[model samples]
Target: MAEEEKRASPEPPLPSPPESSSQPEHPPPETSTPPATFDPSRMIGIIKRKALIKDLAAAYHVECLALCRELLELQKRKDEPFLDTKATEDLRKETLRSSSKRAKKKR
Candidate 1:
């Protein structure tokens, strides 16, 4: 049996930089912007304000619908009793027609 001796290969040399250029070098990007800190109080106030506005908007919508119904009823028969079935039917029809028209307009 013959024994073979193994030789280690030499490592590759690192690449050299190119010759200096006449152009002015630009600096690396700056990332010194401070991270935004959380303000719990301000956040809570904003959330509260948003919730209040949303609730007010919802209330306003309900009030507007009721007012519209009432106005339609009043315009239909100024002196008629509110307990009359005909007035109620007219108000319902007006409300439904107005709502459908608004929906169509939106689309």
Candidate 2:
């Protein structure tokens, strides 16, 4: 325990700067770069556009699921509906393949 404590202890502090050194008495004051002009209308437009895109994407997914559900319902009613099981399996495989690639690495 004593050996571990010694090992964990920090090193000595560094020496302070000397006062004898004759540095500049008064260096010129630093000038700040001006801030960019604000546009309230433009900012509002950008926010609205982003929200619209999000809503559109959500609506698209909902529509796709609704369509798929309708097709399933139709198939259930008909004995021999024209639904391609192979295409469904292929889509599943493709989705899994892409997901596996993403899973191997952290974003």
Tell me the whole-model lDDT of each prediction, alpha carbons only.
Answer: 0.82, 0.85
Model 1 misplaced regions, further than 4 Å: 1-37, 78-107
lDDT of 1 by residue, 1-107 (tens): 12333234455888998758864598667789877789898899999999999999999999999999999987878656655877899999999998887555554
Q: Candidate 1: worst 10 consecutive residues by lDDT? A: 1-10
Per-residue lDDT, model 2, residue 4, is 98
Q: Local error of candidate 2 at 53, Å?
A: 1.2
Identify the candidate with maximal TM-score.
Answer: 1
Q: Write the per-residue lDDT of candidate 2 for residues 38-72, one digit (tens) a residue.
A: 98998999999999999999999999999999999
Q: State every prediction's TM-score relative to the real structure.
A: 0.35, 0.33
Which pairs of residues clash in candidate 2, taking residues 3 or more apart in a chain or in different chains? none
The true-versus-predicted C-alpha distance at residue 93 of model 2, in Å, is 34
